[model samples]
Target: MRVIIVGAGEVGRSIASNLEQSHDVVVIDRNPDVVEGLTYSLDVLALQGDGTELGTLRAADVAEASLVIACTDSDESNVVVCGAVKTVSDAFTIARVRRRTLLETWEGSQGAFGVDFMVCMDLLTAQAIFRISGLPATQDVDTFVGGLVRMAEFEIGPDSPVVDTTVQEADRYDSLTFAGVFRGEEMIVATGDTLLKAGDRVVVIGSPGSVTDFADDIVTPSAEETDEIVIVGASEIGFQAAREFEEHGYRPRLIEQDHDRAREVAEALPNTLVMESDATDTEFLAREHVDEADVVIAALDGDEKNLLVSLLAHRLGVDRTIAVIENLEYTELFETVGVDVAINPREETAEEIVRFTRAEQTEKVAMLEHDRAEVIEFEVGPDSVLAGEPIAAAATDLPDDVVIGAISRSGDLMTPRGETVIEPGDHVVVFVDAAVLEDVLEAI
Candidate 1:
C-alpha cells in the first residue's frame, strides 16, 4: 500500500520504519533535523514541509495513495492536515489527536473529510502505564474498538473476594468472564473449575462496565509496595518510560553506560537516582541491589544487552523484569527467556499508525506474540452474527485456529466456555493462533 505520514517524531518515524518494510511510505516533517534522522535510518521518502499545508498533501500525491496519516505533535495541526487531505484524496486518513475531548465524539463526516480515525497518544501511554502498575488490582486492560469490548487483567489479592472461588463460580457472575490466569510468569488458559489462588493474575473479558465490576471483585494491591525500579538504560525512550513510572509513584534508579549521558539524565530526572555504570556487569548490578529491586526495567539501546540483563535479573529473583527491545522480531524469544514484558516503542507506534491508516475496522494491536498468531484482544460490532450465540456454538463457526478466550458484556467479564452464550452487547476476546484474523472475523 502507498502510505503518507505527517510529522517525524517517535510515532511518525515509527510508522515509517514499520510500514516501509511491507508498503510504500512517505514521511513529511517541518524540521530538517528530524527529516535527516529519518532519511539516515529508513528507506522512506522524506518530504520537508508543513504537514497542515494542502500543497504538501498534493505534493505527496495523496490522491493516489492508499492512506494518509497525520501524526504531528499538535492535534489541531493533524486535524487541519486531515481536512486538507480530504479535499484531494479518497484514501483512508488517520489523525493523531491528543486531547480526550476531541475523541469524545466522532464528528464531521470522517469519511467525507478524509479522516477515518483518530489516535490519542497520551491516553495510550497512560493506559500502558496503568496496566503495568496494576491499578486497583487490575493488571492490564486490552480493548477492541474504543471499548466496545475489553480484556481486563485482575490480580487475585490475598483478600480478593474470589480467593476460594472456582473459575466456574467466577463465571457465574452475571456480566463477567474469567479468561486466563498468570501464575508466576505463565499464562494459563482458564477452565470452568480452575481454582483461584492468591497472587495469581486473572484475565477477564467484558464490556467497560462489566469489566470494572469484575475487577472490583478480585483486584487488590500487592502486599509489598515497590520502592525502587532499576532502569538499565538512559535513552530518550528509556527516560520517558522512567518518567512515566515515577509519575505513578515508583522510585526510579537510572543507569547509563556513558558518563556524560548519565549526568545528562541525572539532571533531567530530579527525583531519580542516576548511576554511571555498565548494566551488563554483574558486579555493578550487585552493588546497585539489582536483585533486591522491586522491578528491573532494561531499556538498553541494544536488544541483546537488554535481554542479557533481564535474564540475569530474573535469575537473581527480581519480582518482575521488563525489557525494552529494539528488535520486534526477537520479542517472543525474549519472553520465553524470562522477560516478563518486552516493550518495543516502534511496534506500539506502528500499531497505532496501522489502525488509523486502515480505518477503524482494523484492530489497534498494541502487542503481538506467538509469532503474531495470538493477539491480545480484538473488537467486533454488536450486529456481528457472533453476538447472541453460545461460545461453544460460535467456536465451530470461527476458524479452528481461533478461540474466544474471553468476553465482556455490560461491564462484566466471562471466561467463556462453549456453553456460554454471547449477547449483542457483549465484546468477545479472541485468541487467534494464525494470521487468518480476517477469516476468523468473517466467521464470527
Candidate 2:
C-alpha cells in the first residue's frame, strides 16, 4: 500500500517508521532539515513541502495513495491537509488533533473536514492516564471488544504473591493468560515452566474481572475511596484529566504557574479548585497538603518540568505520579525515576494511526513489550478458519507463542477454554508475538 504522511515530527516519523517495512511510505514536511533527517534515518521517501498545499500533495502522488495521514502539530493545518487530500484522492484520511472541542465539532457534523478518522491525542492520553489510575500498579492498560477484554502490563513487586512462582502455579484466574514477561530488556515467551521474578514486567490478558483479580494478587491495591486528587498543571492534558476525574465523582485541585491560565481554567471547570501557584514550590505544595492526595498528575507543557514536578510529588509522598511526556525517549527515564506512569501523546497518536492501516479484518490492536508483541481483537467472519471450530482444534495449528485470551459472544465475555467453540461474529482477542504476527494474521 502507498501511504503519505504529513508532518515530519515525532508522530509522523513514528508512523513512517512503522509502515515503511511493509508499505510504500512518503513523508512531507516544510523543513528541509527534518526531511533530510527522515530520509537518512528511515527507508521512506521524504519530500520537503507544505502539507496543506495542493502542489505538494500532487507531487507526493496522493491520488494513488492508499492512506493519507495528517499529523502536523497544528490542528488547523492537520484538518486542512486532510481536507485537501479528500479533494484530490479517494484514499482514507486520518487527522491527529489535540483539542476535544474541535473533535466534538467535527464529530457532531459527520466528516466535517473530509477526514475518515480523527485521533485526539489529548483525549487518548487522558483516557490512558485514567485507566492507569484505576489500576494503580499497571504500567499501561488498554481495552478491546467493548471493554470485555483488557490487556495490562504490570511489574512484579518484591512483595507480590506471584513473585518466585512458575507460570503454571500463578495461573489461578480461569479467564486470564500470562501472555509474556519482559525481564530487563529481553522479552521471554511465557510457558508453563516460565518463572516470574521480582522486577519483571508481565503482560496479562483476559476479561476485566480476571485481570483486576490477578492485579490485586500481584500488587498492593490502592485505597477503596479516593477523595483527594491534585493536578500540577492547567494545560490541556491536565484539564482533560481533571475533567475525567470529575466524571468519576472526584473533585481535583489544579495548580498552574501562570495566573492568567489558571484563572481561565478555573472559570472553565466549575467542579475543580484552580489555584495560581507554581507546583515546583515545595512550600506551596506542602501547605496544600498535596502529599496526602490520592493521585498527582504532572502535565506541564515542558517534559522536563513535568518530570521535575513528578519527582517532587513522589518525594512529598503522593500515592501515584503520572507524568505527561511528549518525548518518547523520556518514558523509560520517567518510570525509572519513580514516576508511577508516563503518558506519551505522540506515541499514542502514532499507534492509533497505525491501527487504521492494519489488515481490514483487525478491529483493534494494542502494542505490547514496546511493539515486540500485539494483542489484537477482531470479529470472527463466516469465512474465518476458526469459525465454528473448537479452540482446542485451532490451538494445535497456532504458533506456541500465540494465545487466545478471551472471546466476546452476543455481548457476553468469556475466557476461552479448549472446549470453547468459536462462532461467526464472535470477537476474539489473541496475543501474538510480534515475530508471528503475519502468520497469525494469515491463519485468521
- Give the per-residue lDDT digits (tens) of candidate 2, residues 1-444: 899999989899978877787789999999999999998999999999999999999999999998999999999999999999989999999999999999999889998999889989998888777877777468888998888789999988777888899999999987898778888888887778999999898988888889988877787544443467898888899999888888887789999989889888888888999988989889998998999987888989999999999989989988778899988898889889888788898888888888888858599998875577888998888877789889989777678788887899998888888799999999998888887787787788
TM-score of each: 0.58, 0.92
Name the candidate that leads on lDDT. Answer: 2
**lDDT (10s digit) by residue, model 1, range 1-444:** 889999887678766755676678899999988888888889998889987888887888888897888887787888888888877788777887656557655464445335687775545543464356443444445666456666666657677778978898876555455656667646566677889898786766656677766665554444344566787888765676677777777667888989889888788788889899878788888877888887777877688888998888888878677777656678768866767676665455556666444344434443333224334444556766676777667666766655465665665556566687777656556655434655664555
What is the C-alpha local distance difference test score of candidate 1?
0.68
- The lowest-lDDT stretch of 10 consecutive residues in candidate 1 is 366-375
Query: Judged by TM-score, which candidate is best?
Result: 2
After superposition, candidate 1 runs with Cα above 4 Å error: 1-61, 64-66, 69-227, 257-260, 267-270, 280-284, 311-319, 332-340, 357-359, 362-367, 374-383, 414-420
Judge candidate 1 at residue 221 and give its lDDT.
Answer: 46
lDDT of each: 0.68, 0.87
